[model samples]
Every structure is written in structure tokens, then in C-alpha cells.
Target: MNVLVIGGTGTTGSLLAKLLPHARVGTRKPVRDGQVRFDWDVPATFGTALDGVDRVYLIPPVGVADPAPVVESFLVRARLVRRVVLLSSSAVPESATGMGALPALVRTMPEWAVLRPSWFMQNFTGDHAVAAGVRDGEIVTATGDGRIGFVDAADIAAVAARALTDPLPHNTDHLITGPEALSYADAAAIITELTGRPVAHRSVSTEELTGRLATWLPPEFAVILAKLDEDIRGGAEDRVTSTVLDVTGRPPRSFRDFFRGFLS
Candidate 1:
């Protein structure tokens, strides 16, 4: 089946593209041979991206407060596609606004799966603010004492590949997570142990974090991120799931193992 992977240059999307070598990569700029020009803001690109594609791995536009309108437009054009898999957050349930609302749309497809993954373990190693702080030997957050089951991006991509290729469609939401739940402090300690560098978790108030994050992100988006941290502080994300193992037939990699692999 022809598959279109939106956000193909992104973390999990790139990994998913690698796993499915024949998949068409939907990106803003079509640099590579298999890449197609697809932009969420540009509705004209949707038809071209969906051309002859039978399956889709959907990643919604980032930082939009409610992406349902534009995403729905895209899906309307993808009516011919049989299977659609959405990448959503574990914190956002179905029927909720923003990414949460996407699962319901994917469910409308002939075959569909919603991947509700916890926070990514790559947050400390990617281009996010946490990664910048990690490089500076400090990780700052408003999440105080709350634990998160941070899954590896590769694992999330693995599950997506399975969901896209499995003979029987998984018409359900999958809560993907790593094996253990860890606090930001625990994450810092692990980084220090692994890298021989003193990494610290500096906890702050939600307001302060919002202000800090606003320097880099849009003010509205910054507020949303800060609120998510506040929710995490209240233990909203402190749990694990067996989605990676169940879908990929292998246990998800632990954060420590991920760090080791990243270091090497």
C-alpha cells in the first residue's frame, strides 16, 4: 500500500520513514526523491500529497491551539485512503480539543489507530528547550516531583510502522510508553551518571516557566506548555503502557538505554 508520512523530517516521522523505505514523505520542502511538498497551512498541497496514497501516518501541525479544522480539511481530501494513524499525546484524550480531537477523525477511516504516546525520551537530546538545558548541564521545568513515562521516539515509530503494515488494522488507541516512570530530577541524575557531567533539574513555578518559555515559543503556546508541566506536577503522566512491546513484539527501550545509545 502507498503510505504518506506527514512531518517526515521530524523525530518520530523520520524514523517511521526509515522503517518504511517505500513510504512517501510529506514535508514542507521536497528535498529528497521520495519526499512530497505538503504544508498544513497550504490546503492546495493536500491533494498532491494524497495522490495515489492508500495509507497515511498523520502528524498534525505543532503549536496550534485547535488543529481540528485544518486537519479535517486534509482528511476530507484523503477519503480514498483506507488506513490512517494519528500521532497524539497520552495526556490528551479523545473528544478534547487540539490533538485530542484528531483521534476521532482517524477513527472515521476504514482502518485506523491512534498512538497516544507519553512524553518523548528524546526531549533531553533533541532541539527542544530541555535539550538546550541538558547541553548546559541543567534541565528546568515546572513539573515538581511528578513522574513521566518517557518513551523513545524510535519505539513510537516502531509502533506506527506496525500499525501501518499489520494485516489486521488496529482500530483502537494505543497508549505507548517506556517501561519506567521517572521524575525530571531522576532524569537529571541519570544524565549526570551517564555523561559524567553535573546535570541539575531546576524546578520553578508554572508562571515563571511560562515567562521563560515565551522567550522562544509563541506566548500562547508557551502558556499551554507550562500548563502541561503543571498537570505533570499533579501526576497526570505517571504511568507506563505495553504498546511498543504489544505492537512491535519487543520491549521498549528504557531511558538509560536510550541515553547510552545516543551517547555512543
Candidate 2:
């Protein structure tokens, strides 16, 4: 089946693209063979990428305040496609104003699946925070003693690939998480064990974190992140779910296993 992967170069999207080699990658910039140029910010480019595509692995652009218009527009243009598998976050509840719209749209599709995965284990090694922490031997966050069920990006991608390739129920949401919940301190300890370094997990005040993030991200995004940290600290994402095991028929990878594979 011909598939289109939005954000094909991103963390989860990259892995999904690799898993679905026959899938067409949609990006804004010029891409190599088997890849198509498509931009979420530019609605004009949606048609070329969606043409003859049977399935889509949708990823909303990062730091977007209003994703509904973009998603709705894309869906309107790509009405011919059979499936649209959306990559949503566990942080976005069905009731949240900004985050709820896409999932709502997916409900109208002929066949769709929404993946609500918890914090990715790759944030420690592949993302900005983790890379910076690895370089400086310190991981700072506003989540004080909060446990998070950090799911692997690979597992999310596996589930997405399966949902896209096989027959599945439409308009379904999967809350995927790791096998266990761990705090930042626990993650730091695991990283130290893997790399044999003195990696410290420092708990910063929400105000301090917001200030630091303001230098890089927009103020609204910074505030949202700070609130999310508070939510995590409040034990909102500490629960482990069976969705991963139910869908993949295998236990989700633990944070320790992720450390072993990625850090070692």
C-alpha cells in the first residue's frame, strides 16, 4: 500500500519511515528518491504528496498552537486516502482545547487510529534536552520526583506501521506507555549506569524552567511545557497501560532496555 508519512525526518516519523520502506516521505525541503516534498505550514503542497496515497502517518508540526485548521485542511484535501494514522501525545487529553481537534477529525475518517504515546525514551539521547544533558552531565527538569511511563519511539512506530499495514478498527485511540514508570532521577541513575558517568538529575523550579525555555521557545510554548512538567509532577503520566502489549502482542520495552540499546 502506498503511504505518506508527515514529518518523515523527525524522531518518530524517521523510525516509521524506516519501518515502512515502501512509504512515501513528505517533507518541506527537497528530499531524495521515495520522498516527496510537503509542508504543513504550506497548504498548497498537500495535494502532490497525498496523490495516490492509500495511507498516511500524520504528525502535527511541533510548537503549533492551533493544529485544527492545518489538520482539517489536510484532511479535506486528502479525502481520497483510505486511512490517516495520527501521531498524538499522551499529554493532550480529549478535552484539551488545542490538542483535541485532530483526534476529533480522525473520528470522521473512514479508517483512522490515534496513537497517544507517553514520553519517549529517546528524549534522553536523541532530543535536545537529553543531548545537552549528556554533554553537560546534568539533566534538569521541573518534574520533581514524578514518575513517567517513557515509551520507546520504536515501539510507537511499530504499532503505527502495523495499524497502517494491517486491518484495524477505525477511530481508535491507543494510550501506549512503557512497561514501567520512572522518574527523572531514576532515568538519570539508569543513564549513569549505562555510560558510567556522573549524570545528575536536578529539579528546577517551574518558574526557573520557564525562564530558561523562554530563551529558545516561544513564551506560549514555554508556558505549556512548564505546565506539562507540573502535570507530570502531579502524577498524571505515571500509569502503565497494556495498549502496547495488546497491539503488538509483546511487552513494551523498559527504560533500562532503551538505555542499553541507545546509550551503550
Candidate 3:
């Protein structure tokens, strides 16, 4: 089955592309071999990326205030693609506005599966908010004692691959999560034990987090992140799910496993 993998250079997208070899990779700049120059902002490139593609692994643009318009326009021409697997957030409500409207939008497809994964385990390895602080021995967040079932990007991509290649699509939204829920303190301790780095988990207020993130991200995006932290602080995302094992026939990797992989 021909497939189109969006965000091909990104963490999960790169892994998904590797697993689904021969698939076209859609990126802003097609630098790597087999990568196609596809940008969500440029509709002119969609036809080339979607040509002969029966399936798609959709990765929405980050930091966009409203992704609905672009998503709507893309789907208008994505009529031939029978299957689409959308990467979304567990924190984004199906009824919420802005990017939160993504899940509901993809549901309009003929056969599609929406993956709402929580925080990724790659935060420490990649260029995420906590990565910079982890190396500096100070991981700061506003998520107090709340825990998150940090799903690994590998596992998320595995599920997406399965959704795209299976004889029948999952045809439903699933919340993907790791095996266990862990607090920031637990994460810091694990980093300290595994990397020999004296890491500390410093919890701040939502206001403080917004101010800190505003320096790097747009103010709106910063507020959205801080709001997610606020939800975590309220103990909203502190739970685990068995969807990973159910879909992949293998239990989700633990935080320790992801960390070890990062170290290697």
C-alpha cells in the first residue's frame, strides 16, 4: 500500500518512514533521499505528495493557532486516500477550538484512526521543553506532583504503521500511553540514576511556566502548554492505558527503556 508520511524529518515521523520504506515523505524541504518537498502552507505541493498514495500518516503543523482551515483544505483533495492516521494530543479536546479541532476534523474521513498520545518519552532526547533543562541538571515544569503516562514516540509510530498497513483500519480514536504513570520527580531520579547526571525537578506555577516558555515560543502556544501543565497539576492526565499492547500486541515501553535508548 502506498503511503505518505508527513513530518518525515521529525522524531516519530522519521521512525515511521523507516518502518514503511517506499513511502513518500512529505516535508518542508526534501533534503534527504526519497523525501518530497511538501509543506502544509503550500497547497501546490499536495498533489505531488499525495500522488498514488492510498494511506497517510498525518502530522499537523506545530504552534499554529488554528489548524482546522489547512486540514479542511487538505482533506478536500485527500478524497482518494482511503486511510489516514492522525497524530494528535490526548490533552486536545475533540470539541476544543483552534488545533483542538483536529480530532473532529479527521473523523470526517472515510476510514481513519486518531491517536491522542500524551507527553512523549523523547522529551529528554529531542529538542523539547525539558531537554535543554535536563542536560543542565534542572528540569523545570509547572506540573507539580501530577504524573503523566509518557508514551514513547516509537510506540506511537508503531501503532500508526499498524493502522496504515492493517487489512482494516482501527476506525476509532485511541489514547496511547506508556505502561506506567510517572511524576517529574520520578523522571528526574531515573535520569540521575541512568546518566549519572544530578538532575532536579523544579516545579513552578502556571504563570511562571507561561513566562518562561514565552521567551522561546509564541505567546499563544506558551499559554496552551502552560494550560496543559495546569491540567496535569490538577491530576487530569495521571493514568495509564492498555491501548498500546492491545493494538501492537506488545506492552508499551517503560520510561527506563526510552531513557536507555536515548543514552545509547
Candidate 4:
């Protein structure tokens, strides 16, 4: 069956695309074979991407606080598709507003699965601001000492691949995470140990972080992101789960192991 992987060039999506045998990559620009042009803001591209697609692995639009409308429109057009797997955040609960609302909508499909993954371990080594801060010798956040169960993007993709191709739909949400919970400071110490670069974690206030983030993101999105840090500071993300093992039949890689390659 043809499977469409939306946001297929992104961190988890790209990995997932490689894992699926019959995957069509949906991106804003189609530069390679099997890569179709798709834009969440441009509904005109949805039909062509959905053509002949039997299932889909969906990643919501980046920086969109509320994606239900656009996603709903796409689902309406893709009603004939057999299964839909959504990538969501652990912080967002089912039926809540914004991305949270998507899980409920996906449940309405013939077959659906939701992956509520924790913070990505890649954020510290990839193109994110945290990675930039690490390059600048520090990791700045408003999360204080609160820890997060940062899972690797590859682990998330593994679970997504299974959800998209399993003999039957999972028909449930999977709370995916790594084996351990660690604060930004813990990650920084690990990075310093690996790279010998003396990286540090700098804690800041939510207001300060929001202002700093606003330099890159929209003011409203900056507020939301800073508030998520506040949630992390409250111990919201300080937990681990075995969903990766249960779903993928292998344990999720730890943050340290995932970091060694990037930092060392």
C-alpha cells in the first residue's frame, strides 16, 4: 500500500520515511523521486499528495499553535485513506486545544494512532536553538532543575513506522520516551564530558526566555514555547515510559548514548 509521510524531510519524519517500504515523502518542495509537494497552508497540494496513498504518517505544521482546522480539512479530503498516524507532544493531552485536539480528530478515522513523544534528544545537537546555545558554550532554558525524558528522534520514527504498518491499527496513543529523565544541566554535563568543551546549562526566567525566543519565533509562539518550559520546570516532563520497547520490540536509546556520537 502506498504510504504518505507528511513532513517527511523533518527529524522524525525523515527517519520514518526511510523505514517504510512504500513511502511517499510529503514536503513543501519536491526535489527527489517520491517526494511530493505539500504545504499545510496550501490545501491545493493535499489532493496530489493523497493520491493513491493508502495510509499516512502525519506531522503537524511546525510553529502552528492550532492545526486542527488545516489538518481537519486534509483529513476530510483523505477520508478514503485507511489509517492515519499522528505525531504529537507528550505535553499535549487528547482532546485539549491545539495539537492536543488532533488526537481526538484522528480517532474518528477508520484506523488511527497517536504518538505523544517527549522532548527530542536531538534538540541539543540538531538545528534547534538549544543546539546553538550549546555551540555557544551553554544551554539556556527556563526549565530550572526539572528533568525531561528526552527520547531520540530515531526511536520515535521506529514507533511511527510500526504504527503505520502494523497488521492492525494501534487504535490508541503511545507515550514514547527514553529510558531516563534528565535535566538540561545533566545533558550539558554529559556534553561537556563527551566533547570536553565545558558546556553549561543557564537557567532563566520564562519572561526572559520568551523575549529571547521572540527574536526568532513569532511573539505568540514564543510565549507558548516559554510557557512549555515553565511546564517543564514544574516537573511535567520528568518521566519515562516503555512504549518504545512495547511498540518497536527494542528499548529506546538513552540520551547519553544518542549524544556521544554528536558530541564526541
lDDT of each: 0.94, 0.87, 0.90, 0.92
- Among these predictions, the greatest lDDT belongs to 1
- TM for candidate 4 is 0.97
Candidate 4 residue-wise lDDT at 226:
97
- lDDT string for model 3 (100-184, tens) is 7888878888889999998999998778879988988999999999999999999999999899899987899889999999999
Model 1 TM: 0.98
- Compared with the true structure, what per-residue lDDT tens digits does model 2 show for residues 124-161? 88658756886689988999999999999999998898
In model 1, what is the error at residue 43, expressed in angstroms? 0.8
TM-score of each: 0.98, 0.96, 0.97, 0.97
Q: Order of candidates by lDDT, top first? A: 1, 4, 3, 2
Model 4 C-alpha RMSD to native:
1.1
RMSD (Cα, Å) of candidate 2? 1.4
The candidates, ranked best first by TM-score, are: 1, 4, 3, 2
Tell me how many clashing residue pairs each candidate has: 0, 0, 0, 0
Compose the digit string of candidate 4's lDDT tens values, residues 59-134. 9888988989999899999967989999999988656678778988889899999999999999988899999988
**Candidate 2: worst-modelled 10 consecutive residues by lDDT:** 93-102
